[model samples]
Target: MIAHPNGTISTEVSDFLLNCLVRSSSWNFWLSLFLSFLFLLAMGANGVLLVTIWLEVSLHEPMYYLLSILSLLDIVVCLTVIPKVLAIFWFDFKSISFYACFLQMYIMNCFLAMESCTFMVMAYDRYVAICHPLRYPSVITDQFVAKAAVFILARNGILTVPIPILSSRLHYCGKNVIENCICASMSVSKLSCDDITINRLYQFAV
Candidate 1:
């Protein structure tokens, strides 16, 4: 581990092995199979929903657009974390490259935040539609959706970038086992050899 001038640490670990649940138990096989089925079901359902919205012009409204965004976010979050988890559980392939781990961490944090923002905007849409029915049309337009999309992207996209970057800068001497299905920010940071006060505080604030 090397200390930096900015009071951060850096490590040179090539990869990490995830400490998946039930690694040696007989139930691992059945759990992996069930998770695989759920993964496929989620992907298929989200894909069909997106395609249906695209094809049907009647459903081409702002609400459907937000739902589509939410679906897309869910698909991404699932894809980001599940395949590797299944590989770990089924084939014992738990080695994730250092950079890949950080990438996964970034995607999980950013997309989840974006999903939350989408829900908040959806709530606002419902409020306008129910509480102020007449002005809803003028208030919520295509332009408003476009702006909200931009806000979601810009807000969460920028805010979550630091998580992976900070984690990458930490020094890891030997402990490279992540005790979770996904490369969560706190889980990964706990393996660092340096102080993670900032990481913990930032995660809490987020």
Candidate 2:
């Protein structure tokens, strides 16, 4: 996939993730079952980890606290797309409504971006604590961490709103059927019959 200076294209990351989400029919029903089972196992493990961390006072340190947050985000990410993805694979939902697609796209992007920012903040925390132990307490306070988490969520959340708003406003003239498994920005953009020259230019610029 191509990379840019500021950020990589959404489709590139989504494409890669979708590939991991899907499996070939050659893998057989049993293998698919086993893989799904394993996914369920991991989800259960994370749930247990969250409960243990929450219920046990000893597990409430900064590192574990961040880990708990990460685990919760992980579960949200999986829940966001996996069900629709599995439905597409097992059942039949060839066409998703524009509204549903937009909602999914925005939400998936918001949570994913939030997780990325959270990881970056966690890295900075580790660096401060390990590299400058004496000053770590002053540098990373409880309020500071709370604000950091809110900043990550708010930053990602605000950026996602425009994507859906822009996409939903477009009028699809021709074949509404999406070429890909999921409703991607490019796929949706390509379906629009209205003047999209500006949109295309902006997309390329991004």
Candidate 3:
């Protein structure tokens, strides 16, 4: 339940309305179709790349392994934000449940961070392979790749957990309309009546 700024305790808010950028009815229709098509194309390409990498034994090296992880992360990111965005654009289905919103926010933050970390690890792998050719085989082993994957998961998963938890704890006494495509941490935090200084700073830190 949200306690209004005027001291009235309102019923628990089950969902939040997402105020998507819909300029006009016709615009929304065309935009949604285009976005949906793009999403499908992206997913299909990534899926094929993943399958090919899995099937071909020659592509089972550290570079291709990291590329596969990147593809998986891309697929996850697209799935996390694009479906709801398409629904909002097409049917004006903007209402997202409170817990669902938090879940989406957490996933977006964590996955993006993990993706960035993956890129860094990939860069380091390339650097070692090129800068020190002889030692590359020993340095960039399958065990090293496995450890990198685990570190990426652990670092992002644990660090980004607090973002949603902190936002969920805020007293959202004001309007519940989020003016964005996704349930971003700052977007949700700004709707709260309580102090959001910590939320902002923590998000910046992350």
For all candidates, what are the clash counts?
Answer: 0, 0, 0
Q: Which clashing pairs does model 3 show?
A: none
lDDT for 85 in candidate 2 is 58
lDDT of 2 by residue, 73-119 (tens): 88887776666655655654445655678777777767777888889
> Among these predicted structures, which one has the highest TM-score?
3
Q: What local lDDT does model 3 show for residue 111?
A: 96
Query: lDDT of model 2 at residue 71?
Result: 88
lDDT of 3 by residue, 47-165 (tens): 99999999999999988999999999999999999999998987789999999999999999999999999999999999998899999999999899999999999999999999999
| lDDT agreement with native, every candidate | 0.90, 0.68, 0.92
Candidate 2 to truth, TM: 0.77
On lDDT, the stronger of 1 and 2 is 1
Query: Model 2: residues >4 Å from true position, as ranges?
Result: 1-35, 195-206
lDDT of 1 by residue, 1-206 (tens): 66778787666677888987674657888888899999999999999999999999999889899999999999999999889988888778989999999999999999999999999999999999999999999998878998999999999999898899989998876588899878988989998877999998888887
Q: Highest lDDT among the candidates is held by which one? A: 3
User: What residue pairs clash in candidate 1, if any at all?
Assistant: none
Give the distance in Å from residue 18's predicted Cα in candidate 3 to where it truly belongs: 1.0
How close to the true structure is residue 12 of candidate 3, measured as C-alpha lDDT?
50
